[model samples]
Target: MSVYNQPRRRVIQMIMIGMILLIVARLFVLQVVEKKYAKLADANAVSRKVVYPSRGIIFDRKGKSILGNDAMYDLVVIPANAKNIDTAYLCQILNIDKEEYKKRMLTAILKNGRVRQSVFAPLLPPEVFGRLQESMYLFQPGFELVQRQIRSYPYAAAASILGYIGEISPQLLDNEAYKAYQMGDYLGLTGLEKTYENVLMGQRGIQYLVKDNLNRPQGPYENGEFDSAAVAGKNLRLSLDIELQVLGENLMKNKIGSIVAIDPTTGGILAMVSSPTFDPNLLTGSYRSANFSRLYQDTTKPLFNRALQARYPPGSTFKPMIALVALDEGVITPSYGYPCGGAYYGCSRPIRCTHSGGGHAANLRLALANSCNSYFSHVYRLSVDAQKFGGIKIGGMQKWADYMHAFGFGHRIGVDVPGENGGLIPDSAFYNRRYKGSWNSCTSVFLGIGQGEVLLTPLQMANAMCIVANKGYYYIPHFVRSIDNDDTDLLAKYKEKHVVAHISDSAYQTVINGMTDVIERGTGRKAAIEGVRVGGKTGTAENKAIINGVLTAQKDHSMFVAFAPADNPKIAIAVVVENAGFGATYAAPIASLMMEKYLKDSIPAKRNPVVKFLLEANTIPPAMQQKSKLDSLNRKAAATLKNGAGGRTFR
Candidate 1:
């Protein structure tokens, strides 16, 4: 009887212990794991706000800040706490009607839950900020003015390169990559900003504020304990020459064109300019939203970065590449010559040569110097229809396309900047698709002169020059030279040497000699510098576009590509002037001026007259110029922007 009673007592003891353990576990979950009560308590005595760090500054090669931050304020609200507030006065300061105010408030509530903050009015004008700061107490814990930063361009150049920032979009917020972002957070929307967003965005910090019974914050809660400091974004150093960028922009003004300059040694972009560019300062602070729409819809299309976006036939500037391919394939030697009587008679439709005289195509260098269309057209036929590869049927067209691909055509170069267009590079497969597999080499002979179906962006053309300048290897073109305290591997790819085609050194040297001759005694005479040896090519690319549903030849686009100090090449450039007639006229002179300016650091007094003429040269068509609205917009908004947007100055 005693043993049985002891076993029953042990069972009773185990039951009691189990009940106590369950009670303790439930208490731990309620006190530590859950936050409902903690939030309720926090609402009563403390307020939490985000402290955004200053965005990264972008500096040119000369250590001048091209893009920097400016102090601004955002009026934010917590929907659940914004009760019995002066909505009417708030709308008045925001310069919005009551209906618009209601729409924003509802949007804020729906985007963020009732507890978190959403931007009520962002990047406020200085006058509005001052008024809101004075009346902030009336809104109590519901609303507050939080300090933030907006981007400013000190040089007011490179608008397309530096890009702009805007509130995180609805689509981005839903992605896993952007999970840390809230509804009102700002991020880079385009260009370099969008490319290096992670490095430039910085880490956001949270600060807890102590508040009184009336829900007014007195000061920091607990002397800043439990607060995290905001880490400012790392500064970015770029290879851009600020002065060169400005000069390029000025040179292309009132004209539809683009210019891209590169450092051949490293593939760092020196200056990239698209004509009709506006001040980058226009896309910052309070007026950003309004100004963006106008700039986007402007008649001249200033927002488009034609240097990296627009597609154009390389024209005669492409002849060098063609010659290289021919020489690389053993189809032609440096001394190979062609007989020309103005036009190439090999194709069914004769292709006319700019140089119709005899002996102009006597040799490779002479033919290149003369830019003989008949010579290059023959070379293209020989390369693609070579009997060694069983002609175009077996591997000829594909081999040519492969060489083009190795030279960075028909694909994204994976530049640091986003939105690079991979211009078309036709292959046998492409022609098969287009011509249903019945095309012949002569049928596409126009490609030999960089016309017909061939198209290329200015960046790609500029990169092609770098290949010739570097003798066979190239680095990926990029803006970022270095980042302050950078811990990531973002720039590793740009630093790697990308070697292409095993063509002999002799071939490259021969071509370089011909291109150098172009500046010395050929069509690119305008590209010659006083003391420096420059190699260049001039292109009068025929322009054809659909006009009223018909593909019409409107006018020729002027193009020039050059590399300076050919013996020790440092800078390479490509310039494209739309509808500006012959390449030797506008494009060659522009490239020549830039080369001179960079090599000497200033155009000598002798060239000042040439500069003046180009600066005043109005190349824009009369009808298109009449339709442009930028002149009126600049006149009206320039003064207003300087005074209204955060009251900060742009230099």
Candidate 2:
């Protein structure tokens, strides 16, 4: 019995040992065989570290810096994980009110679902972070100071073109594309910043770091081998010439207008100067919101991108486009003649020509050279008449309007710049809406001479000149020349041509001859550049306003469009001076000065004896001096024409 009892006791002991062994094996699997799973569980108790990538740089075509980034520190608090934080002390140190602190805390909880830690608000100016550092002991263990990139536009004054950056809103983060971005990430808000965000924003990277129970980072878990470094965003090389841009800004001082200059051959924008421009740098950093709101509320609207947005009547500048359309459509041959005789069709209004007193009968070539309204009126009427045979009339007013559309008038130029307005080109549909289908071509006759319901942006006007320069095709206008840091493949795509309008080579030469004559002996003589064979047209559109229940014409909008080295044009420009009367008097001279500056590195000196005489002729009152000189010039021109003498030659 003793021996049996001993064996049973041994077996019981063996069973106990087997149970212990099984427990040990289970512990080994949970701790050693699956240590990664256990480590993940521990990680849930610690904090996370996120590294943000730096934004890209924006450079001028010459590689000069326009916009770049600077390092900043953001005070990030994890509301859910923040424990026993001294709220009063934290608010005081961060220079925030208690209400603001509570609001941010609640927003973080709601945005991050209270399940994980998230940043409550961004720390701006970096000084806020310095204050937070001093009060770190009062903050929650999970709180952190994360480094961020703040956008900086160094040039400042190029705000309209460079644009500004702002914090991303809640809606933007909901999109799948922006899911990777955390709250408080800065985004390009306007201008080129918003236009090329995709190329300018670089790839994000990740780093795995170990953290303690207090949520403090303990460097990299695997000696930094597992971390991925962020790639800086690619830089953009814009086609804008900074020197010329500054020059243009200076020239536009105390004025209200826009100047747009482009290289006809490449469609490269050289200078896009809008008067009353604001500093882009003012809209950067901590004071961005306050300054932006102030600028936006200003009456002048300095933020308005006038170069691509403002639309106005092409005025007399429309004459050249009308001539080209008439010549191309064969509404009238170049030799078709008409008598200005002060008016056309014997209308009671007498549609007076710009010619002094009353003008003489003129052929098409001479009419275009003199900008004869009667000649253009005859051609416009003939094109609109269905009874006129052998006149290339397919659709009457509609067809003529289509030809203008083909010239890029009354349309957007599809420039790479954002917020481009498609200036109104009143068509049959537009008239139908306004007149309820009762308006006829005669009802909108003012459109024939480039006024009334016909509007165009400076960009479009310049592009029209480019179309003439190209003799048919036009490359889509763009600001970015290339991505500075990108491979050649990305830039190759921009080199492709985007043709807006196409005309026959023969028609182009004919139109070129007309423009050339305009500078040689017409209203655009003021815009002529010596030795360069420049061609251009001038316009002065009446500005009418309602006064005491009557439409009263007051100031005029001056305008000019020109191309240089007429035979092989390199530059095309459009100048519009609001409320400045007579295109030849104001806009033409400005355009000429700009052209001379661009082509010859200086404005052509005032060599004309008449110009010199006018400058020195101070006997007349200041108010009447300009009018007196203009009247004198008109008399001189009329005397020369009456005597059958050649027009004054520009030396």
> For candidate 2, lDDT tens digit of each residue in 452-474?
88888988888889888888767
lDDT (Cα, tens digit) per residue for candidate 1, span 573-600: 9999999999999999899888887888
Best by lDDT: 1
In model 2, pairs of residues that clash are: 156-280
User: What shift in Å separates residue 633 of candidate 2 from its native position after superposition?
Assistant: 44
Return the top candidate by TM-score: 1
Give the Cα RMSD of candidate 1. Answer: 3.7
Tell me the spans in candidate 1 whose CA falls farther than 4 Å from its real position. 1-43, 113-115, 635-651
Q: Number of clashes in every candidate structure?
A: 0, 1
Task: List candidate 2 segments past 4 Å from native.
Answer: 1-46, 107-123, 134-137, 210-218, 346-349, 356-361, 386-394, 436-439, 485-494, 498-502, 544-554, 601-651
